[model samples]
Target: MPLALYLLALAVFAMGTSEFMLAGLVPDIASDLDVSVGTAGALTSAYAIGMIVGAPLVAAFARNWPTRTSLLSFILAFAAAHAVGALTPDFPVLFATRVVAALANAGFLAVTLTTAATLVSPDRKGRALAVLLSGTTTATVAGVPGGAVFGTLFGWRATFWTVAALCLPAALGVLKGISAGLVQEHAADGPASHTELATDGPALRTELAQLARPRLILVMLLGALVNAATFAGFTFLAPVVTDAAGLGELWVPVALVLFGVGAFTGVTVAGRLSDRHPGPVIAVAGPLLLIGWPALALLAAEPVALLTLVFVQGALSFALGSTLITRVLYEAAGAPTMAGSYATTALNMGAAVGPLLAATTLGTAAGTLGPLWSSGLLIAAALLIALPLRTTISTGRGIEVPR
Candidate 1:
């Protein structure tokens, strides 16, 4: 691994911490802003919306920029947004900062995906993605709980400052990466610069047309459904631990840490298997999530049961989620320039939509338990939707190279 890879991972850790930490901070933000919890929860969706919009737009333009320059620009923009977020007292201003931070994060993530893949041999693409995404998984383990703890000790604003400060070190690392001569310009026409196995070009029309393929659309929807299930349940977990399970505020970070630990483990295992055994991994985890999500809903009131199920569900969620994302890359083998953005958009769209649906369940008879039930339904829908997309995943090695 290059020093640049580790630097890129740091970039992900900084942004991902902010993204997942909102789950724990929503209650704090709501209380501080004098808004309903559901209303404050919209911050997560705002971030997701930014990511969804940023993916395609930035991808379209940044596709031709130097790899180092693009990464540096996005990282600096992200830091600036988080700085604004940390200082803002107004809810709307804070909300706007989250969206801006997400847009910068989205552009960085999309470009990183393609950039990381090119660092490895063709057969190791899955592992490259996994390595890049590991930053996200690691952020879940450390940064999410750390953010929650910071929010508890100081304020939600303190956590934003912490994330912004992280970017300083990451920015320095990116400069060092440039000095190492590791990441050069990404020239679509100069050489075989893109990830696709087939011939690639700089044609914008060729890239846009791939977004319309019926098969690609199905895969994107499948990714969206899985994320919908994840965020729907995950966005409300602080409440589930405290309000539903009758735990103290202290337990919130503990609960998040357990889920984070599980996610870290899940993504690590999925990374190794996704390259050669994606079909089997997906086949097994999908059914398990179906059963596990509902079980979490039924046992939401039992502290031990809820905690145990949170770990299990986190593991299942990311393991399956990572595989599906890798599948998107495979299915998008023809859309070299657009593939990363497409994958980013698919997952972010689900992230944007899920919490909105979960917000509807907050005050119902289901109470705090509604989020998990919604998640369960989303998983069922995801499985049904994957039927068509799964046909393309091979049972053998190379995860069935796209024809």
Candidate 2:
């Protein structure tokens, strides 16, 4: 709605392009760098590892700074890293640059959510945060596909260069449009004292204190596990469509576009549903995943069913994604920024663990059915983890979701 939010969306679009373009460019990167495809695949894994490691690292260290300063610095670093990625000759150096860009991207998203959450009144918090996240979702539709086409038309280097160039303008737009008022709202809630943070931070002593409440830990772990399940299938959906569904290669991008369309629609609707009834919305997402997986699995022979399931799964996953983030923020009300950071860390952890499991299963099994089964089982496990969360929430918020 606001110009600033739109600018933040632009920033997110560029960041999304930079982060996800690797999947499309992997074969080229491997060819250019003289590495195996498996080795090139590690670039995606490395980015996940970087985000997981960077989220809290940046939050813990940068918690005291103004949001604008923190966000701008991270954006600049993100742009610079991509530029270097466009030029790096050594594989290791290029890999490191990608990681640096990932760290910057991770840091930016966490801060962006915090910033966005504080932009509006408590009642609109979910909606505001959803709008910011939409940028990332949009990138799946627009940026990554565009990058893939650019990579094909020119080269992988050209794709990186394009992203880097886009980032510069995005950075300028963010600076011009970002409000001091929004920045101040975020800064207003400073980190808790050292004693509180000690009980909260991820130290040997803090783990016991934080985990003493079963409900909070339940929320966090379930959130992470569901995310892991979501990505397990998500990481390879395009290939699955073409290879398993017997859809022609040309349909891969179209299916992804549909997937993104479903996701965008799901996220907006989920935010509204969560606003009206958070608990029920949260409970429903996992089962939807369970149901959708069966339809998706039939893709080995039933192409039409697989295509339909892909859209259904994408919608359900993203809708619940907003609910999960809001839940985590609510659970960690004492530490919004830290909670935001931890939520992202959970996503990154999920991103890492899910794909690893999917890859392992797909690698070992006889057919595409392996990953489909594995993903379904994992989603069931994640749902079981979420069962206890209903008992934890108090209804007093009435969808108001206090800041």
Estimate, for each residue in 1-403, the C-alpha lDDT of model 2 and write its tens digit. Answer: 4566767777888887777788899999999999999898888878888899998788767666666777888889988988898898778988999899889988988787766665555555567767876887898888888889999999999988887777776677667766432442322334211111222324323422543555556666766776677777777777787777777888888777777777788888876766447777766776888877766876556777777777888788777766776666666555655666766876778778887788777766535556666678777887776666455642324232223
Q: Give the lDDT of residue 210 in candidate 1.
A: 75
Model 2 scores what on Cα lDDT?
0.72
Model 1 clash pairs are: none
Query: Model 2, which residues run further than 4 Å from truth?
Result: 179-213, 364-366, 393-403
Per-residue error at 166 for model 1, in Å? 0.9
Each prediction's TM-score against the native?
Answer: 0.87, 0.88
Model 1, position 368, has a per-residue lDDT of: 87
Give one digit per residue, the lDDT tens place, for model 1 in 133-228: 778877888998878778999999888888999998888887776532233333332322333332335477877887787767877888888888
For candidate 1, report its TM-score: 0.87
TM-score of 2: 0.88
- The Cα RMSD in angstroms, rounded to one decimal, for candidate 2 relative to the true structure is 4.8
